[model samples]
Target: MEKRRVVITGMGTVNPLGHNTADSWQAVREGVCGIAPITQYDSSAQKVHLAAEVKDWDPTVYIDKREVRHMARYTQFAMASAKEAMADSGLDLSAENLERCAVIVSSGIGGISTTESEQTRCLQRGFDKASPFYIPTSIANMAAGQIAIAFGFKGMCTCPVTACAGGSNAVGDAFRHIRDGYADMALCGGAEAAVTPLSIGGFTSMRALHVGDDPSRASIPFDGERDGFVMGEGAGILLLEEYEHAVARGAKIYAEVVGYGATCDAYHITAPAPGGEGGARAMAQAIQDAGITADQVDYVNAHGTSTPLNDSGETAAIKTVFGDHAYKMAVSSTKSMTGHMLGAAGAVEAIFTALALKDGYLPATINYKTPDPACDLDYVPNEGRSADIHYALSNSLGFGGHNACVLLKKWEG
Candidate 1:
């Protein structure tokens, strides 16, 4: 089968460091840490106190009071990002074209804040105190559904829920939809707002969060002293269309979606396979799909979650896939600044990768003072670097042993 070409034309994001795509990218390029002492809720009693929360976000400005009340923070973020992405796409959909545009956004855990609030009402007040909108706000697919409804996109709408890989999977699925002639374009990405009391406590009980209070050192991916990931909340959205269609419409292409690969460890729920064998397979599959050799790949936006296991496993996987070239490639984990946005992580990182390819700049993996020998790679450590990249790979590995990779190539028309 001949492969259908796809290109990214628009991007939007609301991250912990900033509320928009440009601001977030600038903060990441500057190696600024967004993690800080928890300010949304009282964290004095919790074992972990730091997170990269979306600071100064007043959803009321973007969404009305009554409308915001019916949704959770994750949904709010998704809606805002979708609005921006559609606007950026410059797609003036007519009545006929409206049915050809689609939306597919995902989340690892959605409406966690709503769940916490409803449970509090049930336990503290009474069952009757629970709001009627609790169920609509708490479901996982509502993020995608609400976005579709808001924009009146009636095409293929889906939400992939593979833990941290959810975002990348959703984007990849959207690409497939257009490639298969199911839709002309898609507004695809992911959103996450899981930093609630129950979420923090659950992850803390599992020893998945960094106990360090210092924002600079809290979520240091590829660092020897890295304790664990810092929870974060945000959303990322991208507008993707068939390459020829975008070109015909005079859309500004950012990068081409060359390949997508996904695999499951089938070994452990939370722990990755030893030596990152599963991750290596995923990366190899993506390279094969792109019909390109590993040497052609210039950079990798790593899924380095700051967890010791993931950092080491990802490094091993890259070595297996690229061999000697792995040492020369500029790899970085923007999570070092954005924290771990869970389902939204992949989308934001993919945006960074596309921007890197577009601007000839690689963002840094900040706070790399203490290096880990086990995770030895270039890592674009501490400072951004300028490099003309032709091809780039973005990786996303999730809980439940899910691994996904996407390959992007510089646009040349």
Candidate 2:
């Protein structure tokens, strides 16, 4: 018997660019940068002051106000995105086998803000002030656990904690679950809300964050002027179902999950493998699994973090995998607009790839002024371009040398 096929039925995201998927997509398409001066707190002491913080978010919109205090912001973001995804899927819980559904949400830095504040209160205010919910709320798996409990998806609830690659890892893992007959459907993605004082300060100390106040210039991937990534926070979720099941339910298919590849450099904790060798391998394996030539991929949602190393490394990876064809593909980093969404970056980008295939439009790498020669591929600079993408690839390379890639094909049937 052939392996089952997986299709993305619904997607939802709450990100720096927008409060929801629609708004986020529109903002990226318009080449509008979401990075702004940090308003979460006074950053006068921090060297990095800009971030793509989610705005106008009201947790009570999707979660109960009473339960909100117990949940971390990351969990809240996950729940909000999951709520939209579940509703968009149109899956009737009463009619389906609830046991066949699953949830896998990822987070790089789970609830650091919660941990930081609680630790601060415990140290400064008193040891008695530490909230009892600290352990429950600060763990990385709570996003998956809480989302599972909230939606009652019980099959295989888990979290992939692969640093920045967590989101793509969860997505790829979910695809396998549906394909291998372990589950018929899965709610999978990633979330993060680690934009606290500690996270910012830590990244700043490591020189991994952009030290700029200009929103438009903060995340200019592939640009010669690029410095470091602009940190962002949010969640992105997708409802993936077996192809036949989705068709039977008259589900609105956004795209089909054709291939997934995961690899690790075993090289470094913070830096990508010297030349993005692991990333190139993952991209090659994904395309091979898709049974498509490099030229068939019309667009690439690059893991261009705007950092000099990452942008150049990803470009080298593309060239290594695609060779001359790499120059032909329209590649862009939505991170140019949404900033670096940490663990949620890959899932959000996977959604962008699907939407690009479905809508026939590619989001641009905004603020691309001076192009770095090493990163010479077409960055789809400045404005959104129209393209009938049959196959799109999204890349996510994280700390600890984790690399994951997913291929999405336009669904016409």
Candidate 3:
């Protein structure tokens, strides 16, 4: 059976650098660093005291005060991005084919702030001190559920919880749904707001966070002196529709979703398989699904999290998948500026890839001062480059050995 084609018509993001797509893309292309000292709370005791936090985000501007109070910060971020994406798409749910539109938003850790706050209240006051909205606010699927309710989407509404791969998985699943005729369009992506005390403590306990006091020096992916990933909080959402529907509606198409691949290491809960065998398989599968050779891919947005294992493992995966062509491809890690958004990483990086295709420009991996022998590739080091990208691949690797890859191509029509 011939599969339906899918294309991205609009995108939205709430990141540490900016709140909207244009501003975020501009900041990224300019190599803006979003990390800073933790200002939301007292981080004096935390080993990793800095994080990339979303600034000047007024949720009340998008949602009612009462509604915002009932939702978690992660949910608020997701809704804000989703609203922007829907508006950008110019697809009025009231006029569109509502039954054929769906929502798939994922999160790695949901509502950490709510969970921490309720726990504190329980300890400070009593068990009865917990807010009645605690359960609803803390669940991971509420982001997708609220989006469905907000937009009155009657099609599939689901969330994929594959740690950092959640965003890519959500988008991949949404694409398959449309391809398989389950839906005509989808509001898909991920949100994360886990930069909390418990999150920091957990990651620090595992020694997975960079403790560099200076924000600019942290999250230096592919840098020889890199320590670890800087925790970040934000959301990225994309409005995807079947290609024909998008064209028929005269939507502003950003890119075409051509392929998707996912795999598991089955080796460790937190580490990649030896030589990145799993990641290689995911990349290869995505290439195959796109019906293109590895050499045909113009760029790759890496899962480069600035961690020792990930950088080396991903480097090996690229070699295994692309062979000598890996050296020629324009690969980069936008995490160099946005820090690690965990579940939201894939969505934002996918946006970066789409923007690269749209604008014929590739954002750089900033602060690439030193070279690692293991990670030798054209990382677009420290500066943006103008390139006519034909096919862009975005990868996401996460805990539980999850790996996902999505291929986006320039919209030809």
Candidate 4:
């Protein structure tokens, strides 16, 4: 069987840092901290009050009012990003084969806010008072479904829910689908808006969120003072097209999707394995799949989720995978600025990785005043720097010990 080449033609995101990919990348490169005091919902009673939210976002501009009423915040974000990505790609749906296109968007904890609203209504005003669109709005796969419906796509519509890894897994699966001749193109990524009262309370109760008062210090990944991750919400979508197809249509290629690797720890529910073996294997597999040496990888957009365990574990995993070269490679976590966007983190960071390859700019790990000995890596601390980047890797390690990675190659042509 002949393997087809897959490349990233366009990307879009509505993140805490910015409303679009260009704006988000600018903020990231500038080392701007998007974490702020929660204003979306009252957090006076909450232990963790700071969260990174999609500020100044008006879904009505991107989605119709009547249609937006049925969609959850996550779906709305997905729709906004899908529209941006499609416009960016300029891949004429009318000219190309619609049956060969697919949508594979994902959300980790879909519509938690919607679920809370309906449940509250059911309790206060009886179950009959709950909205009829509750189930459709809150379901995990609805993001992909809605995108398919909106765009008239007739191929492999899917949503892979691997917790926080959902977005990265979605991208990887789309790449494989195109590479394996299942689809010619795919609109794939993840969207999430889980920063609700219930989610914040649940994470606080589990001691999974940081209790810091300062927004700048709330999400300091790789820093010793880091307590836990700060909650975030948004979406990131990518337009992936076959290489020949992209070239044939004169689409601008951001980067080439060269390799992908996914693994499961099968250990604890929320904790990683003993020595970060699973993450290491995922990185190794991605490198092997890319057919490149460890030294060829110049940068890593880490799944460094501000939490102490994740930072140390990811650092260990990097060292294990890259050996001595790991010390030389630049590693950074944009979660330092954007906070942890749960399911959407993977796709957002993957875009950053591709951008890093495109522009040779490694984003900073903000608020790294005090570094831990455990995470003794060149985390590209505090400021963005330019480097010769040929291959960049992005990681998405989730709560259920799911580790997913994708390798991006700088498009030389």
Q: TM-score of model 4 relative to the true fold?
A: 0.99
Clashing pairs in 1: none
What overall lDDT, based on C-alpha atoms, would model 1 receive against the true structure? 0.90
Show the colliding residue pairs in model 3: none
Residue-by-residue lDDT tens digits, candidate 1, 176-295 = 788878888899999999888899999999888998788888989999999899999899999999888898889999999988889999999899999998889989988998899999
Candidate 1: which stretches are off by over 4 Å?
none
TM-scores, one per candidate:
0.98, 0.98, 0.99, 0.99
lDDT by residue (tens digit), candidate 2, 158-252: 99999888899999999989999999999999999978899999999999999988887888999999999999999999999999999998999
lDDT pick, better of 1 and 2: 2
Residue 91, model 3: Cα distance from true site in angstroms: 0.7
Worst 10 residues of 4 by lDDT: 89-98
User: lDDT per residue, candidate 3, 291-331, as tens digits?
Assistant: 99999999999999999899989999999999999988899
The models' CA-based lDDT, in order, is 0.90, 0.91, 0.92, 0.92
Which candidate would rank higher by TM-score, 2 or 4?
4
lDDT of 3: 0.92
Model 1 TM-score, all chains together? 0.98
lDDT of 2 at 380: 93
